[model samples]
Target: MIEYFKSDARLLSPLYEFEPGCWVNLVRPTSEEITHVLATTGVEEDFLRAALDPEESSRVELEEDQTLLIVDIPTLEESNVEQDESKIFGTLPMGIIVLPNTVITVCLQDTTVLRGIAQNKVRDIHTAMRTRFVLQILLRVAGLFLRNLRMIERDFTKIERRLYDSLKNEELIQLLGLSKSLVYFSASLKGNEVTMEKMLRGRILKLYEDDRDLLEDALIEIRQAIEMAGIYSSILAGTMDAYASVVSNNLNIIMKVLTVITIIMTIPNIIFGFYGMNITGNDLPFAYWWWVPVVISIGGCIGAWIYMKRKDLL
Candidate 1:
């Protein structure tokens, strides 16, 4: 879908007409829609297709007439939580093509930052300038990464508590899922940082000094996100290991208690078996005496207590 917005105001007209500060937001546009955008704005077809490809590497390239900036944006599948490993959650391809008169964005899925920008929540004073718009987009992406990092941290905190309360295999699986998400985010953020740095120093975009400062701020945010992801992953891995060990120890204790009980019970069975055997002196000794049972009961109790105390099962 193609939507046009001018500084926080949505335009209803199909015709692309706007003053200096407008942004054209594209979300999951079809081929014909992409052709229409390019036809209206004079953007290159290859540039648009490059942004549409999911496997496109994050980079910034300049053609004869326009600059193509491809960056990785962290995205999660719908209805997916941090612990859903089977869910599709990773970086998506997002493209920004800066033409002389307009700036066009292409992405496979919708982005919250783009929506916010179109809503005027993130105001851009220079909407007419494509380079400025591109920089603003980069800033928005960096902000999104930071937001995702915070969310991951909060999730880790909750899961960590659960791990301590009751360490189970299911909880370990959830932790693994969270760790995978963090790893994905970290790699994507690092790639984005490199692309932004290239844009800053390459001067292909010819960004103004003030815009350069904005890009620098975005880079810093990306770096912070990468660092936060690393820390969270490390902490989560350590917690998982510790919890697994704890679970194993608990199982060992349970098994030891059951084993000790079985051993104590077997002592009485052995004594009864010997007396039950048909022997010549068995009847004369104490076979019919009630004291024999009493003696066996006392011995069993004493043996069980001693074994339990020695094994720390009591």
Candidate 2:
């Protein structure tokens, strides 16, 4: 779908008439719409197609009188229903095409930050300059990463509490999920860092001096997010290890109890087996069968007590 927004707070028609200082946000644009954008902006068809490709890497290509800046934006993974644990979400591909007169953004999925910007919910902006708008988007992306990291931290803490109380497979699975999410976040931040470095050094975006400061701020936020993700990843890894050890220790205790029970039960079984095996002329002459049973019962009790005491199973 294609949605066009102008700085004057007017929503354009679906035909997407070219205008200055307007943002064209496309989510899963149709082929005809793509052709329209290309034809209106006079951008190369290949450049437009490349921007739409999800697998396209982050790069900057300077076409005559235009610049194509493709950046990878981080996005949260959707929760999976089949698995007990959540799955890690990967980065979404986003395209920022800067024409001399307008800036166009294309992505496959709708992002919260973009939505907020589109709705005029973000403050301190009467008009959207191409450079400032891009910087705002970057800043929002970084902020989202930090926010996601915080959420993951909160989840880890809850999981850790449950883990300390009792070690379960589900807890481990959740820890794994959190860890994977951190991994994804870290990777996306690194990609963002690289893209930012290129933008700063190459100066292809013709970013203003003030906007450079904003980019630096965005960079700082990205770094902070990366650090937070690293810390959480470390904590989750340690927690997982500790949980595994606890589980192993619990299993050992259970096995010891069962082993001791087996040993104690074996005494009576062995004694009965010996007595049941009748040899010729082995019977007692007194015919006091009660005494035999009493003697065997005493022996079994003594044996069980000694075994219990030795194994600390009492």
Candidate 3:
């Protein structure tokens, strides 16, 4: 899908014609739409292809007069129906192409960052101020990371509580999934930080005082996200370790109880085995004396029990 927008009184209003100082947002563009954009906008096909490739890395490139910037953005997808967890999240690449009097954003899927801009939730959005607009998008991406990270943290905490009473793989599976997400976010945030730092130091965008400040703010947010990912990853790791220890300790307790019971049981078996043996079948000591073994077995069991109790093995 493709939509065009122009700044209208601090809001993004849909545009019906190809206008200068407009924003073109594309989501999963078709081949024909791709060809048309290529022909009309004169943007090289390489940039569009990279944007369409979901596996593309985050980087900045220059082709002719346009600057192609790709950044990875986080997204959530529902887990399989059989999975107890509701959703899992990861990053996908988003492309931003800076052209004269226009800026184009292309991504494989719709994101909150774009929707917020469409809804006029952002304070100021002037298409003519392309550099600042890009900064704002970066800022929104950073905030989105923080928002999603908090959600992951909360969900993991809930799962942690569920895992307290019982050991189940479903909850741990979800934790593993979330941990994988944090790894992606960490890498992407680092990539975006480098890109932003380069922009700050390089002449890619002519930065005004306000633009510089906005860029710095976005940079700070990105750094915060990086830190958040690291902290969450560590927390998840610790949780896994704690659960492992709990399980190991429980197993030890179970084995010890079973061992004590077996030893107590063996005492009776020893008495029965010894009493059944006889040198002469008919001349056995007290021929009709089956009760003798029973009394002996009972006495032996009691003795074993007393010994174990004293030793605290029970």
Candidate 4:
């Protein structure tokens, strides 16, 4: 999808056609739309297509009059099923191309970072301030990372609570998913930090006083996010290991109980086999000779149960 907007009175209003100082927002643009954007914006084809590649790294590229800033943005993927706990977090490279006449953003999917700007949810967004606009986007990207990190932390807490009396794999699986997300967030945040630092150096993109402050704010958030991701990842790793040990210990307890039960049960069988042996003359004082073995077997079984219980092996 392709849409054009220009800020009017601190709000992004729709535009019928490309205009100077307008924002071109593209989400999974088709080939024809790409061609039209390239023809109209005169941005290099490589710059337009750089973000379309999922594996693209965060970096800044300058060619003559145009600057391409690729940054990793946070994204959430939720499961389709109602009961599926498959909320996975990831990062995608978003392209921000700043030109003298226009500013363009390209990404494979519409993200909250851009959506907030487009919907006027963000404050002080002006398309005409091309450099500041890019900074705002970066700032929002960092904020989104922090927001998602908090969500992950909340989820870890919830799962940890559930894990106390639960022995299900589903919760552990979800923890693993969250752990994987932390890994992704950590790597992406670090990459974005490097890219932002380069921008901060004033070599790739020019920065005004206000824009420099904004970028610094973004860097601070990104750095905080990196630290948060690392902490969460460590906590999650330890939690998983502790739960794994608990599971193994539970299994051992079950096996020990089963072994004790089996040993106790064999007493009756052995007694019956010995009493039923083919003996021509079996002398017993009781009128019912079979009662002797039955009583003995019951006594032996009780004795074994008491022994195991005292040993704390039951």
Candidate 5:
């Protein structure tokens, strides 16, 4: 759907139709809507469709009077199955197109970055000031990254606690999912940082003093988020490796105990087998006594247990 929003007295107000100096927000627009936006806004078709592709990397492009800036935005996907993980974090591309007449944003999904502006959560928003408006959006995106990264950290802690209590596949799988989320956040944040750096140069988009400061703030947040992603990723990877080693060691210990028991239990089998043979009791007085083998087996088991205990294998 496409919506028109223009800042009136520094507050966002909805418009029924397109207007100059207004913001055009597109969220999963249809083919007809895309065509209409292109014809009405005079934005390049490529710029309109740039962010629709999920694989699109963050970058800035220039086409005469128009500037297309693509950045990665954090997203969360929730699972409904009871056995599956509930939250999975990822990223998607959001396109910010600055035209001579209007500013446009296109994305395949609605994002909190846009919602904050639309909801008047951001201060000093002006759709007519295209450069400043774009900076505000970038700042919001950076904030969203930090927000999601913190949540991921919290999730890591929760899963880590569960894992410490019991070594279960469910908890380990959740940790793996959290690790993957950090990886995605890291890559996306780096891509966005590069794109923001290009804008910081004041080459692709014009930047006034205030606009430059705003962009710098966005960059700082992005850099901090990048650092956090890196740190979290490293810690999670190491934790997973350590857990794997622990599991392997535990399995080895269990198998050793089972093997020792099997060996000790074989003593009774051997003694009973000899007595079951034909004419086996003729040469021995106690050979016919069933209690003799039973006593011997019990003594043998005790000795084996003592040996194993001394070796620290039991």
Candidate 6:
């Protein structure tokens, strides 16, 4: 869908049709809509497609009539994946195109950043100030990354607690998924940082003092998020390794105890087995007693228990 918005006294209002000096927001536009936007706005189809691609990286491009800025935005995919195969999330690309007459944004899915802006959540917003408006959007994207990163970390913490009580494949799977998510966050955040640096260096977008400050703030947030992702990934790796070792050691201890018990129990059987064997000339006076075997077995058990205790194998 294509949404048109115009500035009205520093606030945004929807427009029925395209007009000069307005913003055009496209969310998973249909083929006809894409053709119409391309035909009417003179934006190259490839430019929009690049941003719509899920695998697109963050970058800035310059054309004859427009400038294209592609950035990775954080997105969550909800699914009923089995506990073992759960996943955290990934990213989608968003295109921000600045034209001579209007600003155009294209993305495969709707994002909260656009909705927030439309709802007047951003202070001092105006479509006529295209550069500032784009910067504000960039700031919001960076902020969104941070927000989602925090949630990921929280999930990791919860799983970590559960793992401490008991290690399970399900918990490990969750940690793995979270680790993968951090990787995506780190990559996307770095890509966005690069794009912002290019914008700052190329001077493609005019910035006032406030715009520069906002851009810098966005960069700071991105950097912080990158650092967090790296740190969390490392910590989780170490934790998983440690838990695996713990599990192995625990199994070994249980097996050792069982082996010791089996050895101790076999001693009485060995004694009885020897006693029961017939040698024609050998007989003890107590051997005729019916309780003799019982006495021997009891004695054998006591001896084995004492020996095991002394050997510290109990």
Best by TM-score: 5
lDDT of 1 by residue, 47-118 (tens): 888878888878888899788888889887542344443332478889888877777888988888677666
Q: What's every prediction's RMSD, in angstroms?
A: 3.2, 3.1, 2.0, 1.7, 1.4, 2.3
RMSD of 3: 2.0
Candidate 5, residue 276: how far the Cα is off, in Å: 1.7
Write the residue-wise lDDT of candidate 4 on 186-281 in tens digits. 989999999999999998878989989999999999999999999999999999999999999999989988899899999999988766667644
Q: Write the per-residue lDDT of candidate 2 for residues 24-52, one digit (tens) a residue.
A: 77787899999887777676776667767
Colliding pairs, model 4? none
lDDT of each: 0.76, 0.74, 0.86, 0.90, 0.90, 0.85
Q: At residue 30, what lDDT does model 4 achieve?
A: 96
Candidate 4, poorest ten consecutive residues by summed lDDT: 279-288
Tens-place lDDT digits, model 5, residues 1-314? 99999999989999999999999999999999999998899999999998999999999999999999999999997643357643679899999999998999999998888987899998889999999999999999999999999988887887787776699888787887888788899999999999999999999988999999999999999999999999999999998998899899989989998999899999888877777777756766597577988898899889989988998878
Candidate 3 whole-model C-alpha lDDT, 0 to 1: 0.86
C-alpha lDDT of residue 57 in model 5: 96
TM-score computed on alpha carbons, candidate 6: 0.91
Off by over 4 Å in 6: 79-87, 275-286
TM-scores of the models, in the order given: 0.88, 0.87, 0.93, 0.95, 0.96, 0.91
Off by over 4 Å in 3: 80-83, 278-287
Residue-by-residue lDDT tens digits, candidate 6, 1-314: 99999989989999998988899999999989999998888888888788877888899988886899999998887634474334477899999999989999999988998889988898898898888889999999988988888888788778888786777777877877787788888888889989999887647787788888888988898898889888888998998898898889888989988998888778778767766778542564466566777778788878878988898876
